[model samples]
Target: MPTPGFPPHTLDDEGSPIWLDELAAEDPNHTLHVVRGLDPAAALEVLGAKPQWFQACELPDARPDEWTSLPGAALGAEPGSSATLLAGRVGEWTFVYDDFGATDHDSTEALSADGRAAATSMFSINADASLTYAVDGKQLAWINVDDLDLAEDLPGMPAELRAAFTAAGVVEFDYLEPGDPDYAIAMRAACALAGLACTLDDLRRIPLLVTPLG
Candidate 1:
């Protein structure tokens, strides 16, 4: 069976959607956030999206590559200044994606005000990647893939979360080489524990709410 995770690591894994691979290849500099218990609109607000500019769009239309042609693409003060965010609810979690790492660690606390929130970032241009989680308005854990030795679970972290981390072999992350698929495996496990399992098809078929960063 294909390994369970975002961006399936297996070769010719028919079980996984093609979009996952497409996303990993086409957008190397982006962030994917999953927040429990919040709908698309609520998640967007928590992530600091500008409400007035919000609209519903399909994944292709909202792709960051196409933002240059979006209605408000030129509204920013400078030339070629535009930001786009796409969010949708999948199962119990709201998934948000942006071209850059817009959701920082501090904002994650607010994203989990009612439940939990998990974010995974990949910025190949800067060779940066990180995973962050929060629960009940409190930041619990943050791990930069390049520095796994510095990761430590917080006091209030849920038992299931710890188990998920272990199952994903997070402790071995330090030894893995750059561009390893295990990094994504660990991220998928963490988000899965929070009830956030998303396939690329979900993004393509679902009507995600779109907005600009305020």
Candidate 2:
């Protein structure tokens, strides 16, 4: 039990935890036990002032635990071959941005209010196209407007873009033109070019009717 006079780690009025004190009270013996048999260099190296080597390896201070990424990262094996580039997330549940940029997608998007989605990371294609296919650890993807049949032929798309298609099927592209509806028609046309089945209804949902755009 903690001392009655002593207090729990401090919190700000906003309730942020004071982390410094918590570290001091933690069991160093337990820490050593967890890291035992592992290289001391590796353990101390992660938080140290100087670089170190282990087993002839000059390891980088790469934050493997963070949501790191490279721009233009794709969702599949082919990646940039045909697919457009976008932002990416590389943490536990990896996901790639399917060019979900706004101003080009025709509407200002705010994700569903229930907190199910975030607009900064979510988008639907314009009226005529669909993101049909993707590849990654998370496996999020979209079928083209014309490629919906290919979607069925190849594999399943993840839930995000699939949900978007139930409403619209245009992709977000970097080169969204300046004007009304942004780049919708052209973007949708590109998606339609793929010949994938994307929509059954103007609003593609509820027993999604998939006819091959091909």
Candidate 3:
């Protein structure tokens, strides 16, 4: 089984837990740049300094068959290398987006190996402040608090968050208790949405930010 924080046997290794905003704190002259949804110029605007170009930090290279089996097939670039706009992980499952605008290239495919395979779990914040869960780079579930009517459609949801939907008179489904399949995962999603700095295990160990009962 893959570990919770990092996968096993992937070519890339996990790095320290660094947030998106932390890149600016580091001296740009020394560290290589890793960005998401921003190009070098945009990154400079957001992070305040143009860091070095990115280079994939790969381990001893997985087999070709292993590379082809992942969700998004390693990586993807734009057609004719006009501009690179894609999302994937580098070493340590760090999410980064590289945009090479107006450059000519051969094909749209980027790297050969799935860099995201190293991530065992992750939470993404949607545009509307909703939350989604991804395990092993595959989306497991999502909860859109803005739309209460669509609660039943939420499959594999955790019990703690399900109450949020029910309280709003959205749906009345049996809730999963502590020992349920995705109970912990749901808790993490809820805490993340609430802007809590908690992990999968932290949900059980620490008090939630939103106070699900209140």
Task: Evaluate model 1: give its lDDT.
Answer: 0.54
| Model 2 stretches astray by more than 4 angstroms | 1-137, 149-156, 169-214
Model 3, span 1-214: residue lDDT tens = 1113322221112211222112111211111123222232332323222234232322112213321211112223222222222222222222222222111111111211122211112222221223343333344444443442342453445453343222222112255332223212322233222232222222223221100000
Question: Candidate 3: lDDT over CA atoms?
Answer: 0.25
lDDT of each candidate versus the true structure: 0.54, 0.22, 0.25
- Write down the TM-score for model 3: 0.22
Give the worst 10-residue stretch by lDDT in candidate 3: 103-112
Ranking by lDDT: 1, 3, 2
Q: Which digits, one per residue and each the tens of the lDDT, describe model 1 over residues 1-214?
A: 3243333432223222233334432434556677778888887887788688778764443334432322233232122344456677767767776544555556677888865655444443365656677778877777666655424542344665555554443222455654343445434444556544455555567666777776
Highest-lDDT candidate:
1
Per-residue alpha-carbon lDDT of candidate 2 for residues 1-214, written as tens digits (9 for 90 to 100)? 1111112333212111222111111211001001112232322222221232212211122212222211112121132133222211212121112221222211111111122222211223223433322222121333343434423523353454444333223223355322212212222222222221122121112211111000
How far residue 70's Cα lies from its native spot in candidate 3, in Å, is 36
